[model samples]
Each structure stands twice: as structure tokens, then as C-alpha cells.
Target: MLMLLAAGLLADPVPVYVIAGQSNAEGYGVPHAQLETIDDVTVVWPGRAQKEVGPLQAGWGANEKMIGPEYGFGQAMQRHHQSPVVLLKTAWGGKDVWCDFRSPSAGDFNWAEQQMKTREEREGRSRKVGAFFNAMVDNIEVGLHQAQVHLGRDDLELKGLVWFQGWNDYCQWPVEEAGSPCGRGIIERYPHNLKHMLCDLREALNDTTLPIVIGELGVHGSDVPKSRSGWALRAFRTAQSETASQLDHCCLAPTASFWDTQATDHWECHYNGSAKSYLRIGRTFALHLLALDALPDGQTLKWQASQKGLQAMLRRYPPKSGGLALWGSSIFRLWERAPAHFSEFEVTNVSFGGARSWETLHYADETLFPIQPSTIFYYCGSNDVNAGADAASIAERFRLFSELTRDRLPHTKIFFGAINRSPEKKERWAVVNEANQLVGSYCETQDGRTFVDLNQVLEADDGSTRQDMFLPDQLHLTERAYEGFARVMREALEQKVQSP
Candidate 1:
């Protein structure tokens, strides 16, 4: 028996993929029919005996009838790799990133500590931070070891991680509670905490550049309305994108488009608990992993649109003499819908949706220099801060942008728009204010530059943004807000243009 076990332990290791998160990762999918099975794939999930290992199929959830992303993910991996695969899944329902899965390396937040204390009082146990993180790490380790022992092979390679979470964090706490002096909520702290979690996991696993695929929390489909919760969700989603973009060997799988409202009896946002929804998400996750695997070392996957279309647009609509250009992120993109006219000067919109300050720096040649507008109206940096960048980093990026503009268009009048206050980022207003100050200071130093303040019009007396001025997502402005923005922008531009 010992000789046989030794031989099995020495065999080739199988590729293992670990999936961790909250309820979505645990899956609520109710399969319509018998789920397909992959012979080459196996799964180890938390069970009555700490964990249970079985062939990859639909019954990985708490109940045997339920399924999650793992089912489809395993099938997809088997098809692509054509070898034995192991999936280790560890997730709990209603867990937030700020506390439940917070990484050990990310120092404790007072708000999270308070919540932990509350829970401790109620449950009569001292709950530690990173509880889920610890459980996940331990389970993955145990699952892999068990797989090695059961299969008699020492070759179980940990290939990747699939994270599908955030809804809990978005809904658990109010944005006001995340404000300074108290501490930040999970939504505000997500990107930084997520980055820390990724780093910590990689370090623990002894793989510095482990591949990771983060799934977007898409309970409501693509057209997320502007509401308090919608605002929080959008913030979390933006953080997910930024974390993936900044890290190496990482990719993001969008799931909002796959949501089916009529499928399940549960919450409409939970993809209606549709098995098909989970399956599609899982397949997409696997595909992204495969794509990442195909990339060369030090090269990260770019999930966003390429700059080719923007470049083509620039060529098609070259800036006319005395033209004006509006550039920034989704804020400017939405402004394109406004019927406001620029009769005094031709206007061209060179903005892209979901653009960050760093992205603006990179595409300056295509979006900025070529247009060479007489005046430029800019509104960005919110996404950068949402993506975990500090005020200093945002200021540095803006400084670079300013330098670039001066170098290319010395005569151009640059109007730096202060990053707007939003209900989604109520807790982060200080950072926004600091970034605006830096940007304003930078503009003042330039010969033909000025700063436009939107907070005066958008922010309420209590410092909270006016809810009526924004849509359900809370980040994007309402039509009314845009009108206000237009007035401010036009007034500032007119003043600058008329100045001696």
C-alpha cells in the first residue's frame, strides 16, 4: 500500500483553479435539466466533512440541485487544456470584502472593526478580520493536498483564481458611514483591499504573478439605473476594473449583459438565479483565463476597447481652426447627448467612457495633440480615485497632462474641471477635494489655464451631493446636472476667451 501510494504521489500534477467570493461565487443557479459533466475535471467544495470531492457537475452549491460558475468553468477548462483539472471552491453568502474576505496585509478599518465587534457581541465569539480570506487559503491548501493524496500525484498546479463578489459590500453599509473620522465602507476601500488580497494570495501560494479573473457584479443588466445602491454597485464595479487593469496576469469578465430577470425566483439582480447565467459567466471566466495564459510574460490583458476607433474618429473629424474639444471619461461621453450648441466655435468630443487619468496620459497623442482645439474642457480623475489612486497620484497624472498640453498646444486655453462630488463616493470627497486643489494649482501656474469648480453647484450644504442631480448610478450626472455643468463651462470658457 505504501509503495502504491508513493507511486501515486509522484505522478504528474493536475492544474487547479480556485474560485472565491460571496454568494454569487457560491451560485444560486437552478439548473433546468441534468447538467453536463466533464470526465477530466473534478471539484472540491466545503461539505459536511470540511470538504467533499466529486466530478465537476451542477451540484456544487449548498443544495445538490444548485449550481454556480464552477460547473461551466470546469467544462470549459477541460475542453481547452485536454487534461485533468481540479477546482477548489470556497465562498459564503452575504460576505463583504471589507471584513469577511479582507486580506491580512490590508490594515483594519475602524468601521469594519466596529462591525466585527457588533457581530462578536451578538454571536459570543471574537471574529477576526480576513475570516473568509483565512478560510479560503486554508481550504485551497487542504483541497490541493487531498487531491494529491487521493489521486496519488504530487503534481497539482494552482493555475488561477476567479473572484465573483461585491454586491454584499455594496449593500451592507451606507456611503455616509464610510466618511472620514469613522472609516471607509467596502465599496470605497475595495480596489486597494482587493489589490492587497491578490498580492497576499500570490505570496502565500508562492506564485508572484498568479493569473486572476475578476467577474463584474451584474445583477442589473448593462443599463444600471442611478439609485443609492446602483451608485454603490457602480463604484465597486469601477474598482474591480481598476484592480484588474493595474495588476499583471489579471483579466475581467463582464456579467451584466448575461443577466436574466425571468429565470429565478430570487432577487432580480442575482441574474434571476439562472443556471444559464452562471454558466455563461463561468465560460467567459475560463476564456479570459485562457487568453491571459496565452500572453507573454510581463504583458497584461487589455479588456477595454482598443484606441483604434478613437484614433479613426480623430482622423475623420480633425479639429477645425478655433474649435473646442471636450475630453474626459463617461461624464463627457454623456454630455455628447446634450443638445447644447457651440455656435461661436466648432466643438468636437474626444472623450471615451470609463477613461482614467493615466489612460488620458497614454492616449494624449491621439486624443489631445491632434485635435489642438483653441480651448479644451476636461473632467476626469474620479475614475482614477475610484480605482484606488490617491490624491497625489491623481495630481501627478494631471501635471503630466498639463505639461503635455503645454508642450503641444502652447496657445490653447485649458480648463481643468474639478472632479465632481458623487453620492457613490461620498466617503472619498476629501480625496476628490485634494485632487481638485492640486489640479487648480497646476492650472494657475500655466499661462492660459483655469480651473472650473462643479462642486459649488452639485454639492449640498451638508457636503453630500444632491441626489436629484444624478441618475441611479449616482456617479453619472442627470440631465439637469448636465445643464448646470454646461452653464458653468460656457461661462468659464467665455470669460477665458474674452480675457485680454
Candidate 2:
């Protein structure tokens, strides 16, 4: 048994993919089959954590991007690789690699454009240097830091980095010519600018050997008329293909397939891909990143079936069930784990499996908000190690949960439990402990909401060891530990019931 355990320690971790870029890369070109589910993956909204009912934000914001809330690339990679594959997505909408995402409103190229415009007016030529390059380095550095918080203190062995940009540069054709953010006129110099952007990104990340999948821009066919240069949007596809040629780890994925296959309005930019095309975009991207380049000889993907046009937009799902819970991979038989009292409550164990906060909050509605569970519990925050989020996020999550409880189970009392402290797991996990304290304080101020002290129970009376609570990895829980949490939760619920 000792030898077997030692051998298992040598096994490699599950592959994980990281994706970034501008809005198109963030899922703008191809919205999911439903606005909520992208590529058969669900978007876990963050708001449901507290009590207010609001729209779900795509990708990770306060919380790290989990494979569940973002069940797209992560799930597909895990399935194809036949192992767990965690996908870390930090793409920003309308954000250029050449701007500061920390500022939120830093995409103000108008300032950069104005300086360049005045220079051009004075010198009769485009400015020789643009600040886009330096700005991108900051973004890349910040992005790397954010990834590091979730990734352990080590050089994360990255498998792939999906690229869905160049539109900003391509869009410049019209913008720089028209002198605006939109297509005003055509600037032939823009595509070359895109190449510069790509090189700058590769250099900044020092990731020359990493595999990258480039996604082309797609219009819903109702783009501005240009029987000639008007359709220059299509040329972006060619440019992406060209960028892939120069980069050893780069390849291109045509996104016209993200279009709606059901033949909805071709004018709708979101539903613009055929289903087969969408799957290909997802599957082939994963395959190439895994070094399966020889399969596609002339740009054809080997999917279970071929899809074309509007007919491809149709999608199907295995109906929701209660028989078995879903793991992060969605394909693996996951070991159940949590912060406190997961098994004791049918509160839609939304903590693990990295879901969008919104998805985690609302998951119970599909599971057992009304059917069972007197109070809901959620605890996850290490994802916010940097870019410091305020109590507003904790408040927002609590507010959403409160609202959801009122809507689903009006009589139900919602309890906001603090995130637990990971003693010796990843160093960044310490950040989650700080956020958890805030959550505890935040919940105490609420009326129907009660903040439970999970830490006190897990820790020894003197703040020492409750050794049974955590596993050897320090990330997961031991069976006795899960049961201990549940037992303590039962006592808490009993107290709540007696109080009111």
C-alpha cells in the first residue's frame, strides 16, 4: 500500500487551458446555444451568492472562472484528454491587450487616437509609435498575477491558450480611416498592426512554446454593405490564419460556425454559427492544443457528425437530474467535498466545481430550494487574491441569495456562511480566509440572513488543530471531516429552528 501510494504521487495533474483576448474572445462572436449556456456549457452567474436576483455575468469576476459556470473549454478538454482539465478564463469584454483592465474604463483609445491624430495632422503621417504595446504588457502581467492566485505557487504547466482577437486591429481598418472606433474608412495598415499585437503578447508572456488557437471574427451576414472592401470583415479570418503560420504553437479556428443553425435571423450577430461549426471551434481547438495537428489536412474537423448553416444551431441537453451530482469535469465521478455541512443540506452544493457565482446561487432552484434545505451555504474566494474586490461583492452575492430564497422559498431563512481557511494548500488560498471573515461580518448585519461561524467549529477551541476536518492535500476534505461539518450544521439549524 505504501509503494502504491508513492507511485500515485508521481502522476501528472489534469491539463488546464487558459484563454484571453478582446470581446470576441470573451464569447461575443458566438453567444451560447442559449444566452446563458455557451457551447453546451453553463454560465454560473455570481449574484446568487447573497440574495438579490439579477442577471449573471459571464466568465469569472469576483470568483475565479470555474469549469462549471464555464463548462465549455474545461469540460471539452477534460473529455478529450480523458483526464481532468481545468480551464482558467480571464478574458475581458471590449478590452484591448494594450490597456489596463484594473481601471475598467481604461480602454479609452480616443486619448491615444487623439494624440496620434494631431501628430498625423502636423506630420502628415501615422504616428511612428503607439502606446498599445506597453499597455498590453501591464495587462499581461496583471493577467498572469490573477492566474497565479488560483494556480499554486509554481510554474503552472499550461497546455493551451486560446486566442480570439485581431478584430480591434482589423476593426481599425474602418476606425482609423473613418477616424473613430467603428468602421469609418479602410486602413490597410491595421492588419499588420494585428501581427505586432500578437508578437507583443507572445513576448510579454514569454510563452513562445505554448499552443494558441486563434478564432476569426464573424458577422451575422448583415454587416455593412461592401460588395468590394465592405466585406473586409471576412479578411480578418485570413489574417488570423496568417498569424498562426508564423507562431509554432498557433492555429486558427473559423467562427462562422458559431452562427445560429436554426435559421433564425441572420441579422442577429450572436446566433451566427452552425452547430457543427461551433463544436469544431471547441473540439478542434482542444485537439490542436494537445498536439494533434496532423488530423486536419485541408481544414476539416473530425467531429461525430458534420453540421452546416442554420440547421446546426439546434442543441440538446441531458435533462437535469437528482440521482448523481456533477463534478467539475462533468465527465468524472467526483469525490464530494465542501467548506461545511454540504451533505446535511440539499442546498445545491455550489461551492466547488468553480461555477459562476450567479449559477451557484440559482442552482438550488433546479435542485431543492423549495423541496429541501432550510438554509443555503456558499464559501469560495481565493480567486480574488489581487484586484481587491470590496464588501460590495460579498454584499451583492448575499443580496442575490436573499432574493433567490424569497422567490423560491419565501419561508426559508438563508444563512451566509464564511469561506473556510485552507491551512496548507496553495498559498493564495489564504486570501479566501480574509474574504470569509468579511462574509461572516456581512451576514451578521442582515435580518433574515444569519452568518454562521464555520471557522470556530473547524478550528480547535484554542485555534489549534481539528485534524479530522481537512485532508492531507489541505485542499479537499476527509470523509470524517465532511461528516463533522454536517454534524455541526445540524446543531446550527436546530438552534435556528428554536430561535424563531
Candidate 3:
């Protein structure tokens, strides 16, 4: 191992991937001997010791007899990047997110602990909630330090995290007893708890946009009777999926489909101890990470130019104290050409083409919130639906965006533009409509937020987009479409101005 380190083949700033979860994450599969021979890959199996590093191998599991997803994950990453790869594996079997790895920011688990009747009962389960989180953080720091010393470089980058644990939170506790001290009712709280965990982890690591890939729970082929736990697992899975969709630089890897009964240790939830299953999940995670990493680091050239223009406009004719801002994707980008009638009020176009709700949320602090617009005409979600996001995920992310904006700019009123139909993305029209309904419903419940219906004018009598109003792509708008959108937005803002 020392000789390998001496080879100095790794590039400066080695890419480090952290894999954390419970038993499944701990790897129940039998180790493949060939994994230990992989070149340019370092495995930090903390379960093996406080500071253990070597070529990838098995024995990273809690039992020290099995391998987990890290084996395959490391291999996949190594294959993709020319630079050396480091696998930091930190997980324990039978650990729950509500208690074992619960983040401090998620709030105290005292309510859940108080449910225990006796001091002895409480004491028995009194381990800190973020115990594993602390361990993982420590391991990452130490791993980086050791790598810097041994690898002879200071450019080690903590690239991403892979999360696979949720069974404990969903199965061990009864969903029926959620909100009670006896159980954290983690099912209902899973999404929020998971979100808090992600936020706190990023803060601790000092990378707000660090990419994270969450693996869905359970082995699809397991004979474990889901007759009782099936609904609970589905609920937990939904929470995980929705959380990923709602956050930027986060994605979900469907691992249940990779479950192999032939290799699983326990058929119920753990992927059969099959090395193939773990390998597939790991590769899937790596692929998703690679895809996210491929996205442009900033807005496209055209959008950047548009942003500069908007800035110039703000400088020339500053909004009347708190003015109006139009925000969203391509539809709103073209709306930048709205009729001069919009100039009657202070208006700035902040839209970026192909922007998703998560992307909007990610840059809100810099782009939307700081401007402190009195009124925001928001149009987003079609791109997300086009990207395969479900209606629930789109709605959930938009909710987060709206809430964050409202929190930062309390006086600002928001008008959510219903997504316009696109003939090119016809298959996703249902999802778009559902997302619009969700957004409209949420706006209806808020005090300063209103839903602006663009479909009335943008949609044809047949319920498809108006052919003449769209560009050749059928996704973007023509001058006629922008005219219609501008008219609707102006009317909505006027109504808000006149009310009371």
C-alpha cells in the first residue's frame, strides 16, 4: 500500500466520494477479490480501523465479512475520471436517520426520546442523533488530510455524497404513531428531516451546492412480504425522491430495481448480498453524478447577455423603490420583449432560458431575492417536467422557492404564470398541467401570491399550444405569444395594484 502511494499517479486534488447509510449501505454482499486490485482507487473503510486506506477491497461492512456499494461505486468513478479516486465509507447497520444520523439542525429528538416511559428505557437509547454524521465528517477531514500528506498535493476535492439508508426510518417505526414520542413518525418527517440533513451536511462541508445522489430503498425481488410494510416503504421512497427533486445538485438513483435475490443476505429490504446488485447501484449513482457535473457552471451565453441587459435597464431607470421583476425560463426570456406598456411600472427581466425550479431556488439569493422586487411574475416548471421530473416533485420545489422568496422579501407580491402547453413536449403535458394546478393551489393559499393563467390565451381550442404563436421548436414562443403573456401579466399586476 505504501509503495502504491509512492507511485504518485494520482492527480492533485483527488476526487473523494463519500458513501453513507445503514446496513444496506454497509454492504452485505460478498466481496469480489478482483476489486482489491483496482488501480488509481483508494478505499477508506473506517469500519476496518480509524485510519485505514488501501486499494479497493471488501470487508468495509459492519460485520467485516461483506462488501457494500462502495466497491462498485469506486470502480465506476475510477473508470470515469483519469485522476485517482478515494472512497470514504461510513455507515452502520440498523441505524435510523431520526436518531442515529439525525442532524442537530433537524432539531432535537427529545420529543421522540420522551416517549420512553422510564429513565432506564431512555438511557438505553440515548446515543446522540448525529453520531454517524459526526463520524462521517471526521472521516472526511482525516481522509483529506492523510491524502494530502501521502498523495503529495493539496487539491483533494470532496466531490459528492451517495446516500442509501431509509429502511430504519420507514420500517422499524410505525407510521401510525408518527408525531408521538414513541416513534419519530419519520415517514411524515422523512422529507423535511432529509432536507435538513442535506443542508446541514453541506454547511458543515462548506459546499452549499455539493452534488448528492440518494438511492431508493429495498430490494425489488425480495420475497419479504410487503403486505404490511409495502405502503410504508413506498411512502419513505416518495419522500426521498421528492427531496432530491426539490433541491439543486441532488438526484435519485432507483436501486430497488437492481435488487438481486440470489445475492441478498436478507430478502426483505437488504439487496441480496449479491455483488452484482451493489455494483449496479454504485454505477447508476456515478452516472447520475457525471450527468449533473456536465451541466453548465453558469447561465448560457445568451442568458448572460440578457442578464447584463437587465442590469443596464435597472441602472438606467431604477425601479420606483421596490419595482417589478419577471423570472423564469425561456418563455419569460422572450417576454423580455414585452410591449412598452410594461415600462409604465419599474420592471426588470430576470428570466433565464431552460431554468428549472431548483436552479431558480439555487440562485435566488443572488438573482431574485436581493433585488427586493415589489412584484415578481414567475414562470417555471416546464423544463423540469421535460427533464422527467414528476408533478409532485415540481410542485414541491416550487413551494420551497416561493417560501424562501417570501421569507427574504416579505413585502414582495408574486404572480405564478401557469405553464403553457407545448406541442413538442406533448407526452409531458399531463405533468405540466398537474404541476400548474399544484402551483396555482399553493398561490391561492398565500397572501401576496397570485396564479396568473396564461393557458387561456396560449392554448388552442384543441388544448394544444397555438401553432402560430410558437417558434419552429414548438417549445419557445413567438412575438405573438409574448404579446399575450405580457398582456396577462400587466392585467394581473394592475389588479393587485388596484385591490385595496
Best by TM-score: 1
Q: In model 3, which regions exceed 4 Å deviation?
A: 1-12, 31-36, 63-65, 110-123, 175-184, 220-226, 264-267, 300-500
Better of 2 and 3 by TM-score: 3
lDDT of 1 by residue, 1-500 (tens): 78866765775568899888888888888888998677688888754233388788778864677888998789778876678899888888878777778888887675655654565567686556788888888888888887776666777788898988887666754534324322235566678888888889899889988889898888888688898666767777888888887787776667776778778545664678798888888877776665455433333323145566777776886667668888878888788644355557777777878778766755554456677688888888888777776897787666656655654465888788889888788789889989999888877777788899988778778866688898898888888888788788788877876878
- In model 1, where is the ten-residue run with the lowest total lDDT? 175-184
TM-score pick, better of 1 and 3: 1
TM-score of 3: 0.56
Please give the range of 10 consecutive residues that has the lowest summed lDDT in model 3: 175-184
Per-candidate local distance difference test: 0.75, 0.44, 0.71
Going through the candidates in the order shown, the clash numbers are 9, 38, 9
**lDDT of candidate model 3 versus the reference:** 0.71
RMSD of each: 19.5, 20.2, 17.1
User: After best superposition, candidate 1 residue 169: deviation in angstroms?
Assistant: 1.0
Residues 330-418 of candidate 3 have per-residue lDDT tens digits of: 78877756527477657777788878876666545445654678878888888877777788777766766665565456578889989
TM-score, prediction 2: 0.40
Number of the top lDDT candidate: 1
User: What TM-score goes with each of the models?
Assistant: 0.57, 0.40, 0.56
Alpha-carbon error at 119 in model 2, in Å? 9.7
Query: RMSD in angstroms, candidate 3?
Result: 17.1
